[model samples]
Target chain A: MWGDKLSEGIMSIKEQLQNRFDELTRAEKQLTQLLLQNYPASGLGSITDLAKRSRVSTPTVARLVQKLGYTGFPQFQSVLRAEVGAELSNPIDKYNKWAEHAPDEHILNRFADSVSKNVRQTFSRLQTEEFDEVCALLANTDHRLTIVGGRISRSLADYMFTHMQVIRPRVTHMTSNSNAWPHYLLDMNKDDILVIFDVRRYENDLRRLAEMAHERGVKIILFTDQWGSPISKIAAHKFSCHIEVPSAWDSSIVPMLILEALIAKCKKRIGIKPGAGLTHWQACLTVRAYSESSLRAFSG
Target chain B: MWGDKLSEGIMSIKEQLQNRFDELTRAEKQLTQLLLQNYPASGLGSITDLAKRSRVSTPTVARLVQKLGYTGFPQFQSVLRAEVGAELSNPIDKYNKWAEHAPDEHILNRFADSVSKNVRQTFSRLQTEEFDEVCALLANTDHRLTIVGGRISRSLADYMFTHMQVIRPRVTHMTSNSNAWPHYLLDMNKDDILVIFDVRRYENDLRRLAEMAHERGVKIILFTDQWGSPISKIAAHKFSCHIEVPSAWDSSIVPMLILEALIAKCKKRIGIKPGAGLTHWQACLTVRAYSESSLRAFSG
Candidate 1:
C-alpha cells in the first residue's frame, strides 16, 4: 500500500510546472518562461547565475523555489538533470531488444518503422467526415458493391470482399482477368459502390475501369497513395494514404487500416447477421468464418 | 532559422531535472525530491506551505528556483500548470478532426485505438530471433510451402499464398473445403512447410491437418493469438499476437503486420524476380503484379 503511493507520487518537474503555472507570481512566471526556453540548459546553473539570467533578485528566486516545494536550487537541478539523461538515452539501445539476428536497418526494422510512420501520418491526415460518408454509402444495402484491386492490391480487395460477403449481401469481387470486367460493369447500377485499390505505376486497365464505372454513376472509392492516383479525379471518395516503406514494395499498411475501419463501421451500420441473411450458397461461405469475427450484423 | 531555434530551444522541464540532477545542493535536492514525489500537487501551494512540506528554508527554495532560471516559484508553477492542462485535455478533442460524422465512440476511433495498441504490444512481445528463424525457413527454396487459414483467416492465408507464389517456385493455398485436405496432404513431402492461421473457437479440421502434417515430418508454422491455439504444441513455429478490440470481432491487425514483415523479409531473401523465374503459367500471373512490390527476389 505504501509502495503504491510512493510510485504514484513521482511525476516529472515539467508536469508540476505546467499544472501549477496559474499560481505563479508575475516575476516567477517570467523566470519559469526563461527556464523553459532553454529547458535543462537554462536551469543547470547556480542560483546567482539563474537569478541574473532571469533578471530577478536572489531573495525573489529563493521565495519561488520554496513555493514550488523545493529546499533550494541544488535539489531542483538534480531532478532536471536526471530527466535529461533519460531523454537522451541512445535510440540503438531500444533496438537491442527488437530483432537479435538481424542487424540495424534490417528489413524487419525498416519496414516496421516505415509502416508505423505511414499508419500514423495517414491517420493524422484523414478527415473523419470523409470516412463517415464512405461508411454511410457502405451501409446502404439497397446498392450493390463491386470490389477490384490492381496487381498487388488484389489480395486486399479479396480480403475486403471475403469479409464483406459474410457481413452483408450484394457484394461482388472481380477476378484478375480484365476480360470479364465488362460483365461486372454491366451489372453495376447507379449509386452502387466500386472500391478500387490502385497504387503507383497506376495500371491503364484500372484507369479505364474507373472511367467506365464513373460513367455508370457508380460511387467510386479509390484507395491510392500520397501522390493521389489519376483515378482520384473520377473517384467519388479518395483515400490518399502514405504507403512508402524501405522495401522494394510499397506498403498497404495505411490503406488496409482504412479498409478495416470501413468494414467495421459498415458492420456496425448494417446490424444484420450472416446467418440471418443466408441463402444456401451463402451458407456454405458462412461456415468458413471463424468464431472471432463470425458475428454477422448490419447496422442499417 | 529563428523559428527552428525557438522550437529546438524548448525541452521539457522533466528532462531538465533528470539530466542535471548532479548539480543540486543537499537542501535543494531534498526539496526537489519532495516536489517530485507528489509532482504538480506538491508544488501547487504557497511558498510557506511548500517550504514547510519539503522541510526547507524559503531562501533555499528560492535559490533552487533561481538556479533553474525561474525568477521565482510562481514562474515555475505556471509552466507546470500548462503542461498538466495539455496532458489532461480530452482525447476526443484530437478525434474532432478525425471522423466528424461519427460520434466519439464510433468504430473508427475504437478500432483504431485497439488495432494500434495490439500492433505495438505484439511487436514488443515478439522475439526478433524467432522472426529471423521463421524467415530462414521461408528463405529455403528447397522446401515447398503450403498455407492454410481458418474461416476468417482464409483471406490472410490467401494473402500470403498469393504473394508467396509470386515470389517463390512452389507454394499452394488450400481452399476452405475440408474434404480437399487429404489431396493436399498426399502432395506434401517430408520437408515441406505448412503455415496455419487458427484463432479462437479453434477448428477441429485444422488441428487434424496439423496432426497429419506433423506425422508426415512436415514443418509447421502457426499464427495465433495471446491465448495461443492448441496447435502450438504440435507446430514448430508459432506467432501468437493480441487480437482483442472493442468491437465484437477479433482484430487481425497485429498478425497482418507480422505477415507483411515476413513477406518483406522473404522477398529480400529469395533474390529472384517473377520474370526471371517465369514459366508460361507464371508469366501470365506476372502480368498482373503492378510496379510496387513488383520486384520479386529471394535472399537465400
Candidate 2:
C-alpha cells in the first residue's frame, strides 16, 4: 500500500486507520471509523470525550491507540495535533475577513457579490463544445462512470453521482477512502469515464488514480478551481470552475452550476420519461401554486 | 407513529421501509436501506436490477416485498411507479427548457446568467442581521445544533455538518430518515437550533419535524428556496435563497453560497486557533504556490 511507506511517521491518523482497518476488532473498528469520519478534531480534546462520542470505554480508545503503535492516548493526540498543519486540504483558515479592497457594505452583500461574480466569470470561459461533449459521453450508458472528489468536493461528486445514477446507469461515487480506489479501478474498461473533482490543496491520490485510469484508456472529466489542479494533464475534458469566495473555503457553487447543467443536458439527450404519478402530481402542484399566487422568492 | 395512520394504502415505500426496518432480517435491513437511500428511483427499476444493485438475492427481494405487504414483485413495482408522481419534492423534472426569451446563445452562457442573477437576487433581499444571528447561535456550543435537509438538499446539510463538527462540538447532523428524527428531537433543549433546507416540492415530513422541533423551543433556522417552504411559518430565522435554474432539478448553488457564508462567519466567531503543525504546513504550501506563479485562474 502507498500509505505503508508513508506510515513511518508521516501517515496521518486517517491513513493509519484505513491501512490497518482489517486488523481491528469489531468494537475497535467502530471506533476507528468514528475517528476517521471526523479525524483530527475527533481525535483531539481528550480520550474520554472521544470514547464517549463513539460510545466506547476509555480503555478501548487506549488499546486502539496502542494497537496503532502510539505509546498511549497522549501520543496519539499529539500526532493528531500535528496533522492540524498538513490537513489544509480544503477551503479553510480563510473567510476570517472580507476582501481588502471592497467598499464598505454588509458582509452578506459582499459575499453575494463575490459569488455572483464567480458565476459570471466561470461561464465566460466555459466551452459549449466541451460541455456538449461531456453531456454526450455521460448520456451514453456504455460509458461506465466513476466519480471522485477531494475532501470538500466529494459532496459535489455525490450530488453528481446521485443525479447521474438516477438519470441513467453505470454510475459510481467512490468513497473518500483512497485505499478502496484500486478495487474500483480494477473494474474500469476502455472508454469508461472518470469524473474527478479536486480544487486547490489538490489531493495526490486522485491524481494517481486519474493517471492509472488514463493508462487504461478511461476518459477523464475534471472539475477544478480556476487556479487549476495538477490532475488536468491527464484529463480528457476539464471544467475550470471559479471557486474563490470570501469564505474560509473555496465555494463549490460554480462547479455545482456546471454539474447541474450537465445532468440536465444528459437527461434531455437520453430522453427518459418520469413516472405518470409524478407528472400528474407535479402538474397539480404547479396549478395549485399558480392559482394561489406564488409567495416563493424564486423556484426552478 | 405517523407512518402507521398512512400505512394502510397511502403510505409511500420509504415510510413503509422505515417503519418496518426493525423487523427485517439483517440482509433485508440492508436492502431496505439501499431502497431508502435512492428512494423511488432505487425501487422503480426492475426487481432484478434493484437486487443486483443491493447485492441481494432475487428471493430476498421477493421476500422483502412480501413482508412489505405486496402480493408480488409487480405489485410492489406498481407502488414504486406510483411514487414517481408524489416524489417531486425536490428540484426534479426541470432544466428541460431554456427561458422562452433566451436568444441563440449557448446553454452554458444562459445558465451562468441565471445562476449569477440568482446570487445577486438572493443577496439583495438577504437580511444581514438574521445572518449574524444564525452565526452567533452556531458559534455558541451551549445551543446544541441539529441540521437537516430534504432529499437533494441533504448533501448541503452534510457539508455544513462536516465543517461545523470540525469547528466545534455539540453538532448533530440528522440522517435523511424521518423516523429517526424523533430520537434526536428527544434531546433538544430550549434555545437549541434546527437548521433546515427544503426546496420546491417541499417535504411535508420536514414541516412536521419543524413544528415538533418548534414546540420543543428549539430555534429554527431555515434555508428554503424562493417559493418558500411551509416550515417558514415556524422558523426563527429564514433564508429564502433563489434556487431556480435551467436544469432538470433546482440548482443548489445559491443555497450553497449562503451556507458557506454562514459557516465562515461562525468559524470566525468561534475564533479557535489551529495547532502549530497545520499553521506551519499551510504557510509552506502557500509560499511555494505563490513563488511558482499560478498558472490557473481565480483563487480564493
Candidate 3:
C-alpha cells in the first residue's frame, strides 16, 4: 500500500515536503530549511553535499529522504529532477507530455485552449486599480521610462519599448548587455519609472538592478508570471500574468496582451491624437520611398 | 441619395476604384494603372505630380478623384490618409480606437477576446499539410536554416532563432542591417531553408531579397499576414497568421503561437530527447551560480 501510494502521484513533492515539515527533528528541520531556500538545487546535489550545506550529518539527510516517502536518496533526487525538468523543458518536450496524457486532443486545439485559458486567467487575476496605476505612470512623460526584460523576455521589452516610444518621447528599452545596465540604473532618478519583465528562474542581474533602482526611488512596475517572483516585493506596482501552457515553455500571450491594454490606457490618458505620429513616420518612409533601389546600394 | 450612399461606408475607396475602372477615359486608365501599382503612395502625392507621373493632364487626375465618389481631390486625399493611418497606428493608438468603440467592455476583456479570436482564426486558416511540410523542412538537420523578419518582426525572428538553436544546430536569425543581407543571401544553397517574415506595408528590400534567394534555388518559407504579400508568390512554403486586433498595431500572439507549434513539431520529427538541452543550459546557469554577486562586478 505504501509503495502504491508513492507510485500513484498521491501527493506532489512540494506538498509532501510541507505536510511533513513540522514532524521533522531539529537536524531534519535544518536540512528542510536549506532545501526550501535552495529548492531544486538542494535536491540535485548528492546526499553528502546536501548534509554539508544544511550543516547536518549524512544520516540525517538519508532519514529525511526516506521519511519523505522515497525509498532512498536516489528516489528523492529523481522526483526533484523531474520537477526541475518540467519547469525548464522547451515547447516540444511540453507538447510530448501533453500528447501522452490527453491522446484525444489535437496539438493545435491544445495550444488554442491553453492560450485562451492563460489570457482569461490573467485578466481575472488583475486588479483594476493596479493596471490604472501602471497606465498613469506610463502616461506621465516627465518620468523617464526605462524598460528591461531578461533573455527570453527581451522581445517583449522591445515590443513595449517600440510602442511606447511612439506614444511618448522619453521611453527607452534597456539593451540586453549586462555591462550597460549599471550605467542606465545610475542615471535613474526618484521621479523616473523602471518597468521590468522577469519571469521564473528569475535572473540574478534583474533582481540586483531592481534593488538599485528601488534605492534611487525609481517607481518600479514589474510584470512577472503567476509564480510571483522575488522582484515583486520591491516593485511599487507588481502585476503577474498567467503564463501556464501545456508545453514546457511558458506562453507569453498574457503579458503581451496586458502590454497592449496598458498602451491603450496610456494613449487615452496622454490624449495623443490618433495617427499623428504614424502619419509623420509614414510620410518619412514615403519620402525615402523605402524601396529596393534605395537598399540595393548598401547590399552591393 | 448619392451623399447618403457615400456616408453609409458601403463603398471603400479600393472598391470604388474598381467599380468605376471600366468607365474611365484612356488618360484616366493610365492614371488608374499607376495608382493601382503604387497604391496608397499614389494617393499621397499632389495632383500635379500624379498627372506628371501618369503622363495625363492635371484635370484628368481631378476627374478620376471625382469619379471615385469624393467631392474633390482634397476629399479623396483625406480618405487615403485615414486608410494609411489605420494601417500604421502604434499600439497606443490602436488601444484608444478599441476603447472608443466599446466603452462598456473592460480593456482586459477586450484584449482577451481579441487575442482568443486571433489565435482561433490563425489556426482555422492554416492548412495542415502546409504546416506539416514546414515542420518537415525545419526538422531536416542537414538543411541550414536562416530566418529574416522585418523591422517590427525582428524580435519574433530572434525568438524563433533562440528556441531553434537550442533544439538543433545551425539556425541563424538574420540581422536587420541592409549591408549584411547580401553576404547572407549569397551563401544560400538548394539544401538550405530561408524563412522570411514580412507582413503588410511590406518592404521592397525584403521582396528583392526573396527574389534573389529564389534564383539561387533556396527553399523559401514565408510567414505573412492575411493580406498576403508580394513575396508569397516566390516562396516554396507560405503561411499567413491573422493579426486583426482592437489596436492599430498587429498583435503578434498568433505568429508567436504558430512558431511554438512549429518548434514542437520539428522537435518531434527530429527525435530530440526531452530536457536534453534544457538540462545542460540550466546546469550551466547553476554552475555560474546565477546571482547578484556574480553580476555585481560587471556593474562596477
Candidate 4:
C-alpha cells in the first residue's frame, strides 16, 4: 500500500509537471529544465550528482522530487530510467506491456486525451480566415478539390473526400484513382484546393505532390508533423499536428478528429447535414437501392 | 446547458442506483425498481404520476429527487424528459461532440475510466475454470483453432490469431485462405476451437459457421454483444459485451480490451516472457523485421 501510494504520488507529479511544467517554482523549474534538457545524463545520474548539475540545493532536489510526487529521489530516478528505456525503443516496435499495465480505462483515457489534444491542436491551428478561403474554394463550381494520401492516411483522406464529394460533387481523391492522380493535379484550376496529408517523414510521394501542386499555383493544405518537415516548406497552408505517437503505434484519433472537423466545417459552410434528418439506416437503404440495380445489371 | 446538466444529474442517479440498487428500503427500492424496470417510461413521465405509480409518498418522492442531486422534483422530471428524448434519438449514435466537451485532463480521465471499466467487467465475467478448459482445449494436439471476422473486427481477430499462430504454429485464420473456410468448417473435428467475433452482428457468415461447427461437436468460443444471440447459442463458451454503438460504425473500447486480455492470457500461459535482457529497441527490431517482411509479402 505504501509503495502504491508512493507510486501514485510520483505518477501524479509526473502528470502535473507534464501539464504545468512552465508554472513550477524556480528551483522546481530549474530541476525540470535540467531533466528536460539533459534528460539522458540527469536521468542516469544519482540524486546528489543531479542536484550538483542542475545547480539546485540537495534538499531542493529532494523537494522537487517530492513535488514530482515521488516519496523521495529513488522512485523518480526509476521512473526516469523506464521512460528513457521506452524512448530508446525502436519506432517500428509493437508496444507490449504498456497496455498490459494499463487498464481499459487507462487506455481509453489516454486514447481520448490524445485524440482531444490532436483535435484541439488541429482546431487551433485552423485559422478562420484560411478555413473560409478553403470553403470558398470548394464552393466554387469550376474547380475540383484534389486529396492526396496513402495507406492509413489514405483511409482518412478518402473518407473526407467522399463525404465532401457527396456535397461538392467535384472533389477528387488521388488514391481512389492513383493512375490519374498526376492528371488530376495537372488539370486542377489555380483556384482549386490541394488537400494533402503527409504525416511523418515516411511518405516522400505525398511531399513531392504537394511541392508540384504548390509550384503550379494550386493552394495546398498540408497536414504534416512539425514545422521543418519537407511538406510544410512547399505547401501554401500548413497545419501542424502530431500523429507519430510516443508508443510506436498508429493513432486513428488524429485522422478521425481531423475528418470530423473538416466535415463539420464543410457542413456548416455548405448547408449539408447528412441529408437533413435522414436516418443512417435509411441512407444505407437508399445506397443499396441505387447500387442494387447496377449490381444486378452487371451480374445478369 | 441547463437541459444537459439536468439529464446529467439523472444519469448520476442512475449510476448510483446501478452501484447500490440492492440496498434501498422497500419504498425507495420500489421507486428505484420502477425506474429500472421501465426506464423508458420513467424517463418520459412527470414526477407526480411516476412517484404515485412507484408507491412512494410525495415527501419520499421529493427526497428521491433530491437524492439524485437535482434542485427539486421539477428539475428531476426535466432531466428524465431529456433522457427519454435522448433515448428516442438513437442508442448507438456516435457522440461527435464527446471530445469537444472533454478537455485535456478530463479526456484522459474519462478514457482511463472507460478502459478500467471494460477491463474490470471483462475480468469479472472471465471464469478461471473456463480459462483452464480453454487452455486444455488449445493445448490438445487434436484441436485446430479457426477464427473469422470482417472489416475492423477482422483486423483485431487477425491480430490475435496471427500472434497465436506464430507462437502455436497451428491455428488457422479465415483470412489466410478465404476459399478454404467452408471446407474447413465442414471438416471441423470435435476437438477444434472455432473462435467467432460477431460484434454488431454485421455478418451472418460467423453465425452460420459457429452453428455448423457446433453441430459437428467442435468447441466454440464466441465474443458477442448480447446473450442468446445466434453466435452465443451455438458456442460452448460465450463471452458477452456491449459495443453500444450505431450502425456500421466500429469504433469501440470494450471489444479491443477483450481481444487484448485474451491474447495476454494465452501469451502468459504459453510462457512467452519478454525474452531476457533484450533492450526495448532490440525487441522492437526483432518483431519489426518479421512483421514488415510479412506485411510487404501480403501487400505484394
Candidate 5:
C-alpha cells in the first residue's frame, strides 16, 4: 500500500522539471528549457548527446537527473522509456491495473481513457514549427517523396502513400523486401525527401536504407517512438511519436494521427480541391456497380 | 452566430435516442431496445428489416423515426451518416470549426479533442456482447479466418493479419488484387470467418467476394463506416466505425483502435503470453545488429 501510495505520489519527469524550474542553477535551467522544448527526444538520447545539445556539461546533465530524484541519466532515461511503454500497454493490462486500484470501473471505459490519453500526450509533445517544416517538405512539388517504414510500420507508410498520392504525384511507398533500394535511390538527390517510420525494435534494413539516403544527400524526415532511433542523428527533421499502449503491440494511433495531420497540411499547401480525390474514387465505385448490385441482390 | 449556435444545439442521434427513451409505446420501445442493443447497425438497416427484426409493424418504424423529430427514416439515417462522417474529418477541418466558435484555443488542442471524441464515439457505439462474440469467433481454433479489405483499407487488413498471425496460426490476409480470391476461398466453409473491411464508396469487387463467401456459408464480419455498406445485409456481424474527420479522407483511427481491441481480446482468449511476440520481434532486431550499429555509428 505504501509502495502504491509512493508510486501515486511520484511526479512524472515532466512534472519534476516544471516543479524544479525555479530552483535550478542557471546552467541547469538552460538544460531544462532545452528538455522542455524538445522533450522525450531530449531525454531519450545518450547523456553526451544531451549535454552537447543542451549546451551543458555532462556532469551538469547527471546532476540534473539526480536533482530530479533519478539515480543517474540512464535511470532517468529508463523512466522516460517506461512511461512510453506504459502508454502503449494493452487495454487488459490497463484494466488489471485499474482493477487493482479502482475495481468498479468498466474495462471499456478504462480503455477509452487510455486511448484518449495516448492521443493527447502525443499531440502535446509535437512541436508546431517542426510539424510545419515537415509539411513544407512534403508539400514541395519538385521534391520526389519516398516513404518507407519498418516491417510493422509498413502499413502506416502505405496509408500515407495512398492518401498523399491522391493529392500529389511521385509519392512512393517503398516495400522493405524489394532489393530495389539501390534502384529507388538512384535518382534521389538533395531535392528528394525520404520519410521513414522506424520505431523501437526498428528494422536494421530500414536504418541502413536511411543511412544510404543520408549519404546520397537526400533529406530524411524520421518518424519514430520515444525510444529514439539511431537514424534520428542523420535526420533533417525528426518526429518522435508516443507509441505506448497497454497491449503487446505499440499503438499506431498516434503515428496514424500524425500521418492524417501531415496529409491535411499537404493537401492545403498544394491547393487540392476539397473533394477531388473522393469524387474520383466515387466514380470508380460507380463503374463497378454491376457486381455490387448483384451482391446486394443475393443478400436481399 | 445564430447558425453556429443552432449547429451546437443539434443533438446527435444517440442523444435523441436517450432523450426519447421514456416516451415510446411498447412496440416502439421493443424496437428502441433493439436499436439500443445493436446501435448504429440497428439504425443502419432498411425500415422493413428493422420492422421485421424488432417484431414491429413497418409503419411503427416510420412513427418511431417521426417521433425522433426526423421527417422520415431516411432523414434520420442521413443524420447518423453525417455524424459518423464528421467524426472522421481531418484535424484542420475540426480546427476551423473550432476556431469559428472557440477562437482562442490552440489547433493541436482542438485536434486532440476531436481525435479523443472520435475514439470515444466509436467505442460508445460498440456493443459489448457483439464485441465478445466476434472475439469468440476469432479465437476458436476450429474456424479458419480470412480477412479482406477494399483497396484503401488493404493496409488495415495487413495490419490485422500480421498481429493475428503472431498469436494464432492459419490467419490469412486476402489481397484484393492478383485474382487470388478463387484460390483463397476454395477451402473456406461454414465454419470459417470471412472478415471484410469495406467503408464508404465501397468496392464492388469486395462486395462480390463477400457475396461469394456468403454463398459458401462462410460467416461474414463486415467493418464499414456509418454510411453502412450493402454488404452489411449479408454480414453475420457488422461493425460500422466512425470515420468522419475534418479532412477529405476518412480517418482510420477508430477502425485501427477496434482492430487493436479485437486482437487484444483474441490474444486473451487464446492464452498467448503477453510478451512472447515482442520477445521474438526483439530477437529478430538483435540478429540485424550490424545495420543497427552502423546507424548508431553515424549518429554518434
Candidate 6:
C-alpha cells in the first residue's frame, strides 16, 4: 500500500509526518503529537504560538507541516478542520464496532443471535413479576392500547401498533413529536394501557408522556436500555435491557425485538383459534397482497 | 394443565379441543389432529364427512362439540374461524416452536448473533472481485455522491450519505418520496456515483431509479442483503451481505452496521483528517443544541 502511496498530488500532511516521525528531533515529536491531538486548535494558532505549545522553534513548526505532506501551515490546517468536521457529522463507527467483535455468520443467524441476546438480557434484568403484572393490566384494560416511540424507535412502534390493532383491534400508535403527544394522551384514560419505548438518556417528550400517563392513572409499560433512563423511574411496569453496542450512536435492535415478543405474547393471550375469523384475516391479507402487487406492477 | 373441569366461559374452538383432547375416545384422536391442523376445514365439514375422514362414528363427531367445550358445531366453528383470522393476519410465525426454545440474554446480543451469522454467509457468497472493483470505482469517482433508501433502511442510507458527504462535500441524500429526486438525477453523469441501499426484494421506486441511473451511464453502487435479489443484478458495482432479520419484520440492525463499515472505508479512502472542515458540522450541532435548550429554558 505504501509503495503505491500518494501520487504526489493529494499527499496529506499526516503522511509526511509518518515518513519522518523518528528522523525528527525531540521538539518535532512534541509538535506532531500536539497537532494530531488538538488539530482544531492548530488551525487557529499562529506559528509562534503553536511552537510555544509544542516546545519547538517557529521554523520547526513550518518544517513539520511540509514533512506532514501539506504544502504549508494553511493547507495542513484545512485538512485538520475537514477531519474534525467529518467526525461531528456522524458517530456511526462506535455503533458498528459491536458487530465487528462477534463471530462471522449468516444474516439469519445474526438475526437469531441478536434477538436471543436481547431476549435473554431483557428477561434476566426484567422483574418477571412486573412484566406479568403489566401483562395482566393490559389484558384487563377495556380501553385501547397506545404505543409511543420516536426517531429510530418509531418504525418498531409503528409495526407493533399495526399488528396489535389487527389482533386485539384496539391498539393506536402516537405519531406526533414529543411536544405534541400530550394531545393524544388526553384521549387516554385509566382503562388504557400506554406502552413507551425510550432508550439511553431518554427524550424529554417521552418522559413527559410517561409522567402524564402516571398522573392519569394509565398503566405504563416501559421498554428502555439505560437503567437510569428517565422513563424507567416513572413507568408503572418496566422492561430494561442493555444495548451497549460500542458506539455512542444507538444501533441496537433490542427494543424493536422486545416489541415483537410483546406482540407474540399478546397473540397468545388473545387466543388464536381456527375458524371464520381466521378465514376473514386470510381474506384481508389476500386482498391487501393483491392490491400491493398490482400497485407495484403498475408503478413498474 | 387441563383437569376434567372446563371453565364456564366462551373459549375459541381450538382451545376447546386442546382442553378436551385427552378426554376424546380413541376413535376421536384422528379427528382431533385434523381439527388442530386444519381447524377451518374441520369447522366447515359435515358430521358424516368429518366422521368418514377421521374413520370414526357419527356419534363421535357429534360428541366433539360438547367435548371441545362448545355448545354446538356452529359455536365451535365460530371459535375456529376466529383462530383462522388471527393466524392469517400474522403469517410470519410458521410454527409455535420458538416457545420450545430457551430465551437468550439480551435482544442486542440476539441481533448481533443474527447479523454476524449473516455477515459470514454473505462474505462467503460475495464475489470478491466485484466488490473490489466497486470499491475502486467509488474511490475514483470525481462527481458528487447521491444515496437513496426508504422505510427502515433510510437510517442506513442517511448514515452512509452523511459520512460520505463530509469526505466529498457534493453528496446528496434523497430522503423524501416526492418526485423531486428524478429532477436531481437528471443531471447526474458518468463521473458521479449514485449509491442505492436496496435489501431483500428490491423496493419499487428504487428499482426504477437504479434502472434510470444505469441508462444514464451514471456509476451505480448497490448494497444489498441477498445476491439474487432484483436490485443486485442491475448495479454497476454491488456488495452483498446477509441483512435478513429473524422477525422478517425488519428488526435487525445489521444493514445499518454494514453502512457504517462502508462509510469507514470511504472515510479511509478520502482521508478523513482530524481537523478537516469540521467547524460547520460542530457549529450546526452546537446551534441546534443551544437553541433547543434555550427554548426549553424559556418555556420553563
In model 2, which regions exceed 4 Å deviation? A1-104, A272-300, B1-104, B272-300
Off by over 4 Å in 1: A1-104, A272-300, B1-106, B272-300
| Off by more than 4 A, model 4 | A1-152, A155-194, A217-219, A226-229, A236-239, A243-246, A264-300, B1-300
Q: Identify the candidate with maximal DockQ.
A: 1
Chain B TM-scores across candidates: 0.62, 0.57, 0.59, 0.53, 0.56, 0.54
Winner on DockQ between 1 and 2 is 1
RMSD for each of the candidates: 14.8, 27.4, 27.7, 21.5, 23.2, 27.5
Residue B227 lDDT in model 5?
A: 74
RMSD of 2: 27.4
Residue B119 lDDT in model 1? 61
Model 5 alpha-carbon drift over 4 Å, by segment: A1-107, A272-300, B1-107, B272-300
True contacts kept of 6: 0.01
Q: Pick the candidate with the highest lDDT.
A: 2
What's model 2's lDDT at A109? 58
Total backbone collisions, model 4: 13
- Candidate 4 lDDT by residue in tens digits, A154-259: 6456556655665555677776334445666667657778888766534545655666677778888766664435877677766565554323334544444444
User: lDDT tens digits, residues B173-278, model 5?
Assistant: 8876626677787788998999999987787778778878899999999889877899999999988888876666687888887888788777766765454455
Model 2 backbone overlap count: 17
Tell me each candidate's TM-score: 0.62, 0.57, 0.61, 0.42, 0.60, 0.50
Q: How good is the docking of model 6, as DockQ?
A: 0.01
User: Which candidate do you rate higher for DockQ, 4 or 5?
Assistant: 5
True contacts kept of each: 0.18, 0.22, 0.22, 0.00, 0.17, 0.01
lDDT of 3: 0.72
Q: Model 6 TM-score?
A: 0.50
Residue-wise C-alpha lDDT for candidate 3, range B67-178, written one tens digit per residue: 7767888788767655544443332332222222234377766776677666666676677767778888898778999998886777778778866776666888887766
Tens-digit lDDT track of model 2 for A241-276: 888777677888888888888887887776554554
